[model samples]
Target: IAGRLRGLSAREARRSAEALAHELDIGPWMDRRALPEGGGLSGGIRRLTGFAMAIAAPAPLLILDEPTNDIDASRRRLLWDALRRRGDQGAGALLVTHNVAEAERIVDELVVLDRGRVVAAGSPARLRGTQDNDLRLELQLAPGAADPSELATAPPVRQRVRTGRRTLLTVAATDAARGVAWATAQREHGLLEGFTLAPATLEDAYLALTAPGAAPGSAELDPADPHQETAHV
Candidate 1:
């Protein structure tokens, strides 16, 4: 499309399209000329295709919402690289995603909204610094290991969940070290497959800022504002 808009020959158009396919990691799938019926193309690939088409267009601004949904890790990495490159070239992109980690990685500026209101907006580092609590420790329980109840009783655990062979523990940041130490000790004793400690994230900050009972600021959210609602951009 870009080649045609720029009045390039057919050869140039093919080359341009090929280059973009490679960049978006869709080269292998390009040979499937027929569109997938009944959504046979994975949701991620469909999104990638749309993104590729949009980026290849002559638009000065691109708005993508939840661009990474259902995308595999490898392809998602490619998408991020493409977005970063576009940013480097001074393109304007407004990306909306619930994947706060991905947003943190790619966005120079972050705007967080909850219930149709902008609760926080700033750099990832700045927003992350405002998050003072809510650390999560996830334990992958080995099958037939220690009882779930025993693990749940460990220190600093505000809440716990027991699934097939996994347990999720939510804890306070002030007690994160203690919680991690306890979980690690349990792992060393052969009671778990492994454990991971997660620090407060942009998601945490967002929740904190937009949580019910949080002090109301200048009203920025409009429940009636159509644009405030979530949409594919």
Candidate 2:
């Protein structure tokens, strides 16, 4: 139907749709109908179909809202590649998403919104600022952690932020090994489910910005409008 709507011949429509199905790794389910919630295709596949439909429309510019929301990592990579190809073919897209880490893989420009208001806008590199020089130690707290931050109090931990079971400890590059070893020991003591060490990304900057009364070096909010903050990263 997408091809017909686009005025493609019957054969062309089938070819186009099937090719897209293969691209989205949904070729095997081409004939199956999709249902919502507890329906035929899994929720993730249904979401993938929606993305396929949008791509089928062949819009010169697409407004995608969290297109990769339910998608797994491999298929998500396919989606990103598909969009990059579309851009190469002269199409454009305005992608809206909250998966900051994943979105960094493909977004050419980013606009971070906080409570429906713009908080920051820039290319990923521009937004990361000096964050690349810092290492992030991510810890997954065990169930019912009374104080997940107890492990973050040590020296190398220049900053620590906790949300739910996830905790991000920021430290300078020189302290990367020490930070990792400390988090490793904590994991052994059953304080953490797991932990990973990596360079901080835009998400780190974003968290610091939205954090109530964040420090001046990372971000600064206009005193006149508390809601507005400039992300220096």
Candidate 3:
């Protein structure tokens, strides 16, 4: 109906919408109603439908607000891919989202905002901060671990971020073994449900760049870069 109203022939509009639906793997819900009340497509499915409708339009610029919220991992990947295709075709987009970890790989440039102020802006690599040599140890604290913050005191642990029962520890790449050993000991002692030690990621850098003492902002834009960028706030 949207396509037809936009001057697209029924067949053309349907093909466009269906193609997008399948691309996002929501093909099964194409015929469902997006009723406002109840018994319609689910929250995730409804979001997918809205996404299809947006891309179906011939808009040159797309402003996406938390497009991946409530979306599953696989479909979230598909949605990002669809946006990438849109960029490849010369259209541009402004992606407003807090899921920087998921959007990191796709973003050509990243702009970090703190309290409505632009705290940092640059290519993902440039903003990775001084922690390029760092690794992240994500610890899933056990119920018995009364205070997870104490783990930050481990000799090689350089930085830490804790939210609820999960704690992420930043350690030097050279000390990966020691960090893993420490987490393993905690897990062995039942202080952790389980823990994962991996190399630092864009999300880790995002946390660092947004730390209290970070410089106001400094980044040179590359005019030659793609116009589609993700803004992380």
Candidate 4:
């Protein structure tokens, strides 16, 4: 990228490359002549190398398409810090990602797309604030215990999904106190391990917008859409 952007000489490019490699934790591979065959480089390394090139380039605007792909949590944090520093230095970035949590942390504005169409656009806070009183409750049930059938049919529950031994229950915010009380009662009966209550997040908003019976402003998305959920970018 440095070469293409400014016709940097091999020596000059090497300086920028080395700096970026060190920042992204790829300094060990900087002096290597060729990547090893077969396993060559891990997917995360390859992705981070590409990012290092772009970040080291002279381009004022960085257009990244899922820049955090295949990277570990530490590398992902490094990537965010790098991009944030670039922004602080007056560079512009356009990040394309399905990771709502990442976007919430990094971007100033968000545009949600569904089937090639823009479904929603706004700052993270604005979008999150639009949702009505909704709360998410996660409960870990005791081993070998089944979730009570009545819990799913409870009046406070708007939706309930069970994964392995854990169940995620969505309820009205107004009913959150009552919901916790009910969970506490169940815990007394040895049905629950523990539980958590929290306000709706960007993920919750995304799911609601794309749910099968989504409201007028939001469109129903196909369950098969791979981009519906993603790792933090």
RMSD (Å) per prediction: 9.3, 6.0, 7.2, 7.2
Sort the candidates on lDDT, descending order.
Answer: 2, 3, 4, 1
What global local distance difference test value does model 3 have? 0.72
lDDT-better candidate, 2 vs 3? 2
Task: Report the candidate with higher lDDT, 1 versus 2.
Answer: 2
**Model 3, range 1-233, lDDT digits (tens) per residue?**
77777778989998988788779998887777666663566777877777887788677898888988888888988998999999998888888899878667888886888788887777776665435677778989887576444745463555555667877776678888877777787778788898887876777666655666554652222223342122333
- Candidates in order, TM-scores: namely 0.62, 0.70, 0.69, 0.68
> Could you tell me which residue pairs clash in candidate 4?
none
Candidate 1 colliding pairs: none
**Clash tally, candidates in order:** 0, 1, 0, 0
Pick by TM-score: which candidate is best?
A: 2
Residue runs of model 4 more than 4 Å from their true location after superposition: 9-11, 34-39, 130-135, 138-176, 185-195, 216-233
Runs with alpha carbons beyond 4 Å of true place in candidate 3: 4-7, 37-39, 130-134, 137-172, 175-196, 213-215, 218-233
Compute the lDDT of residue 24 as modeled in candidate 4: 87
Q: lDDT per residue, candidate 2, 1-233, as tens digits?
A: 87778777888888888988999999888898666563888767877888887787466898899898888889989988988999888898999888888777788888777666565667775555444577778888989755444634544555566777987776678988877777777777788899888887778667865666555334342244332224542
lDDT for each candidate structure:
0.68, 0.73, 0.72, 0.71
**Model 1 over residues 48-92: C-alpha lDDT tens digits?**
877886677445678998898888999999999988888888888
TM-score of structure candidate 4: 0.68
Residue 184 lDDT in model 4? 88
Clashing pairs in 3: none
Q: Residues 1-233, candidate 4, lDDT per residue (tens digit)?
A: 45547777778787888778878888887665545651567788878877887877666899999999899999999999999989888899999998888998999877777666565777775555323566778888989887962445343565555667877666677778888888888878898888888875777556655555454344232234432322111
